[model samples]
Target: MKKTEKIITNKIKINDRFWGRYLEVVRNHVIPYQWDALNDCLPDASPSHAIENFRIAAGESSDDYYGMVFQDSDLAKWLEAVSYSLENEPNPELEKIADEVIALFGRAQGEDGYLNTYYMVKEPNNRWTNIRDNHELYCAGHLIEAAVAYYQATGKKQFLDIMCKYADYIDSVFGPEEDKLKGYPGHQEIELALVKLYDVTGKEKYLDLSKYFIDERGKQPHYFDIEKKKRNDTKPFWFNDDYAYHQAHKSVREQKEAVGHAVRATYMYTAMTDLAVKTKDESLKKACEELWNNVTQKQMYITGGIGSMEFGEAFSFNYDLPNDLSYTETCASIALVFWANRMLQLDANNKYADVMELALYNGTISGMDLDGKKFFYVNPLEVQPEACEKRKDKKHVKSVRQKWFGCACCPPNLARLIASIGHYIYSQKEKEVFVHLYMGNETTVQIANNNVKLTQQTNYPWDGNVSMIVTPEREESFTVAFRIPGWAKGTVMKLNGEIIDHIPLIKNGYVYINRKWQENDHIELSFPMVVERIQSNPQVRHNVGKVALQRGPVVYCLEQVDNGENLHGLILPRNAELKANYNPDLLEGVVSITGDAERIDQTNWNDSLYRPVEDKTTSVQMKAIPYYAWCNRESGEMIVWVNEKR
Candidate 1:
């Protein structure tokens, strides 16, 4: 497969009608609140103690490691988000704090260049002893990502050199060489991060290290098992004997199913795709293709959520999607986005972007609240307040977003992803520019031997009209491929107020418009936005007789706040006339759907669980808000798929 180059986030400035406000909130509100959380200034939030851990490790304070083994990642991820934000909106104060933090990081490094606070402060001798359960390498992955972002955003090499030292140290410790330890991370993040590190520095060693980790994972005589027996620690840890939990059931090349923790598996798959495209490894590419099909075909929800059960935050089986008991961790969906986007880079396929957009608009954004303060770690398709309260298994499914979590991975992950969304919109390969996502943004692309600035305007996920104005330094010939989203039916593309009726160059999921561009050359796209009814595969037992409402990329849900109680007693008629209406005062001004439906009256039914008797039904109107907007109002029953009236 041929790979396309991407226009990095730094070159893109967002003025999106839909995502612009969200990005602003992330920069202004979320970043500050999270910084406060890291410093333990937020009352009632989980104590991060992240900054204190760094202080101790840097010898600035007399204390020990105060949080989880991976507590350092919170600050690392925050710095990454700050780096992206700094590229667009420069803040001198934030840059000063970041420089101070980088200096502390330099001081915190040991002589050998290892930089984990937990082991450095607490288990100095036990470094790399329990890589299976501990997150030393996982934390290093986030730090490396932070370093790359910081270097790119600010052109500062202080933190980059620190991470490089750490990576060099890791390269020396673990590899295929006889002198190195045959070990990989229990969590799968560093694999992808190493690829990013390699890309930035053009370091062959880092690329070889990432491939070594990917190739060595889940091989015979399993290194994780060998490492576990070597430790001989009686203390219980979150280690599963089933190697599938970490996606090590077999070597990655031999693995076909998406198993284990959804986030870990997706991260590993993402790295594998990266290596596959970079190295042109057909075997690895085939495995990725099969796994991708397995995930989207059977395991995924209509909201693009994965990880069915919370047991291991893992997949159960094919066609085993459950609604209320789902453990669709927000991070997992974000990882899905990561994996899907990489797949698109390998080959410009609309199928990949379809899932990416689905998750971004619904499953992924649903992780955070509209105010950008509270966040949901687990996003379930259906929510029952009583179930979330009383049932132990359903505890992961929260009716409302929480301030913080003990693990606290999803919030920072969401923040970083949201802050760096510009990278996902456009990709460049030589003279070809692919517009994969639609949003209002102005970006400069280095293509056709010229820096071409393009401005996009759209109110996407609600409306389907898009306008693009192209400005070039001089008249240049280039091909601009606009992604026709799979959901966009009957789409029309126009150039300079004239309809494009000639033979259109359509491939994968994009329409290629090739021409010599001039300043202010305009183009327009029209994708009709209408209420859509979606259904699941028959094998999905929970949604066997149901239909879901959708408009463009946004999935709509019937919440108790809008539909009243006894939500299950209502049914959307098969021939119901659904209408799309935009209300400015509703849920941050979302386009809502209204339709005619039947409400069953159970007042005359006996008090038995099941009765073979007729029940009165009344014709009524039902309203549904976007799935991401659910639980924002008064907590009540909420469902994505509703029964179709007979």
Candidate 2:
């Protein structure tokens, strides 16, 4: 089995106008603010006390354990983000702080290598007793990931050694062995983290354990059911015994559709893809492909958001996406990106990179505000402040970003993703270098026993032009593959000021340029940027007669601050001349889409419940901002799909 190579985060330097600002925010603002939140230092925000739980479990603090069962994972994720941020740009103070946190982990871990502050401080006697509800393995998975990332960033093995001990302990407790308990994580994260641990330490046991967890899930006499019987508890299951909620209804290979909690489903799929690549498991690879198709085609939002309903924070049936009541959790989309990257590694196909870019530019970043302090847990396509406040169904939706939430998973997730954005841009396999995303950055890749330095300059998502400068250490033969986005058309490429008119070289959504003897080669690509109106399939009942605006990779939305009240009443004419204008003064310099539309004049309705069919309308100019930038300025209603006038 041939495995794909990943570029270390420290090797790539991002300097784009768009992502560069986000990276700065993650380093300067989000990381520090989250550090404070973890310590319970934010006076105006909800208490995190995640750090305190570790202290209390370590006998360094007297406070009782507080917060959710999965609170410890919050610190784990934050530390992971800190690892990436430090790799991108070194900071001594932040490194010191992260070092202190690692020392805390050392003290909190038990003699038998058991960790998890919630169980240590509160439920020591009941450790691993309730893997069905509690996120014990989930927290361990995140801590292991942070440990791997920190070790990769700083070459420090303190945290890595700690997690290795905990992982070894876990391996002893659960497996196919007769004495070990036959249980897996209800949350489906450790499987992927184990793959990372294996990658770092070359420990075959970690790889085998990850495969064991994936293979054991949803088997006969399900583990959750067995555990429930062992505990001998009469209480009903929290999710009403719907095994699908935990994605345990059927074996992984037999399961066709994407189901269960959105984050868990995506995370598990990511790990499955990883194992498939590492072990050459054909059936597992096929299952991943089917699930990937179902997710990106039938059940995904236009903004690359998944998990349609808030009931279980899970995916509904096909084409059941409702904009206003959608629970497109930020973490789910980030996890989708994770899964997409793994799929790309499995095969350098454009299909995976397209969705990865979609989520990165729209759904994922929409979870955080421009300033990086406020965050959104549920990213609704359409929001009304009054409906969010008054309606029962829309209660999960928020019209504005909050300081912090009690659950507090999405914020740190976003921070780490943005901090590690460089990892998604490029991938390599042997002599082939694949450019998955067109971000402005520079990196060096060893191809054919020669060092190749590649630099990219682009104002992507706002402009469609990209320029690349490739410099190899000596005359070497290699291939450079650049992704031609699915949304782009009439793409023109130039090699050293000469047009490459051959179209046969483009395959699988990428244009391949193979040659030898390069010292200062230059490549230019142009993809004409235009405002386009997109319509959903008729099966999507909510968006049947509506159209969404998109320019480049950025999806646009209508906010009441720009459109006015009753955004639903606005109708965009099919023939309206949509124009894209770069507004440097608005929404942190975004390309806003403006067009002509009609509004239903309800001024003289006089409180009538029903009125005669009158086509009384007024001409109005509508302005749509990038979906990610909405709610950053004003508090009002926002809608992505507007009524279309046929």
Question: Once model 2 is optimally superposed onto the true structure by TM-score, how far is the C-alpha of residue 572 displaced, in angstroms?
Answer: 0.6
Per-residue lDDT over 368-463 for candidate 1, one digit per residue giving the tens place of the 0 to 100 score: 998889999999988888889999988888888899988889898999889888989988778888888999999887765688999999988778
Judge candidate 1 at residue 29 and give its lDDT: 93
* TM values, all candidates: 0.97, 0.99
The lDDT per prediction is 0.89, 0.93
Candidate 2 local lDDT, 1-646, one digit each (tens): 3555664455899999999999998999999999999989988899999999999999999999999999999999999999999888999999999999999999999999999999999989999888988999999999999999999989999999999999999999999999998899899999999999999999999999999999999998888888888889877676656888888889899989998799999999999999998998999999999999999999999999999999999999999999999999999999999999999978888999999999999999999999999999999999999999999999999999999999999999999899999989988878888999997999888876788999999998799999999999998988999999988888999999899973889889988888994887999999889888999989999999999998888999999999889998999999999999998899888999898899998888899989889998999999999999999988999999999999
Model 2 alpha-carbon drift over 4 Å, by segment = 1-3
Weakest 10 consecutive residues of candidate 2 by summed lDDT: 1-10
Candidate closest to the true structure, highest lDDT: 2
Q: Distance from true position, residue 580, model 2, in Å?
A: 0.5
